[model samples]
Target: MARLVYQPQSPLNATLAVSKRWATSLGIWGVGAGTAALFLLSVTPLVKREFLVKVPVVGSYYEDKTPASDKPF
Candidate 1:
């Protein structure tokens, strides 16, 4: 007769197979990705303008306007 082994069902049971150094590297990567996402979200207008200016046919006509006109009239 063979004995059955009991496996833990907690989340901690799932462990990354990589080394500790690689785990730290993953943290760094996560931080970098979060920072980049935040930066992109913060500068959405600038990113949109850049994308608009990169279009093949409409790029040449795109212009950046002064911020003064954005106030409520």
Candidate 2:
């Protein structure tokens, strides 16, 4: 014979349950915001060196091919 245990859900569980309903929408919005941020920051050297340059397909596109000596500044 097995005894049944009753467990009450906490507020955190309730919040998580509600959030599950909006998960897909939230994910889409998050991705859109991140993409917009990346695009807006794309011209910055930090973003270019740290992120855009590591993207596989377009990595070569962002690579700086110029020799250091060729730069005027």
Candidate 3:
């Protein structure tokens, strides 16, 4: 008769698999996506003017007043 052998889970594996790395990477990805979206919204006329007009104080910033020199891709 052969006995079944069970292997114990190591703390190292658990620690390595679950860490702040996931959250950190997620935050980085979110910032990158937000930056891309903001750039796209700024470079192109995709965003509707009505939306910017409705926003409170920040409305003026996105109201297509950006100078040619200040524009970025």
Candidate 4:
């Protein structure tokens, strides 16, 4: 008679395996959503000042180039 080997599966192991499988997909979705959100908010003053203006390549594009004396308030 051949003996059967039983392996115990832990919940932690199951969770880790699932997370590993989905990690890349989840990361891509998150990054895409974040970039979309930033673009949608690009017209907002707060978003431009706090985030867009800090981006090295596009910072100058978002910067307020108008002189203070323009006086629109």
Write candidate 4's Cα lDDT for 49-73 as tens digits. Answer: 9989999998999999889999598
Worst 10 residues of 2 by lDDT: 57-66
lDDT of 3 at 42: 58
The clash count of every prediction, one per candidate, is 0, 0, 0, 0
Which 10 successive residues of model 4 have the least lDDT summed? 64-73
Each candidate's root-mean-square deviation in Å?
9.9, 6.7, 9.9, 2.9
> lDDT ranking from best to worst?
4, 2, 3, 1
Off by over 4 Å in 4: 1-6
Residue pairs whose backbone atoms clash in candidate 4: none
Task: Score candidate 4 by TM-score against the native.
Answer: 0.85
Per-model TM-score, in order, reads 0.35, 0.74, 0.40, 0.85
Every candidate's lDDT = 0.67, 0.94, 0.73, 0.94
For model 2, the stretches where C-alpha displacement exceeds 4 angstroms are 1-13
Q: Which residue runs does candidate 3 get wrong by more than 4 Å?
A: 1-20, 46-57, 64-73
C-alpha RMSD of candidate 1:
9.9
Better of 1 and 3 by TM-score: 3
Q: Best candidate per TM-score, number?
A: 4
- Assess candidate 3 and give its lDDT: 0.73
Lowest lDDT sum, 10 consecutive residues, model 3, at: 43-52
Candidate 3 lDDT, 1-73, residue by residue in tens: 9999998879997677776558788889999998787667754565537555457987777777778899896
lDDT of 2 by residue, 1-73 (tens): 9999998999999999999999999999999999999999989989999989999999989888999999998
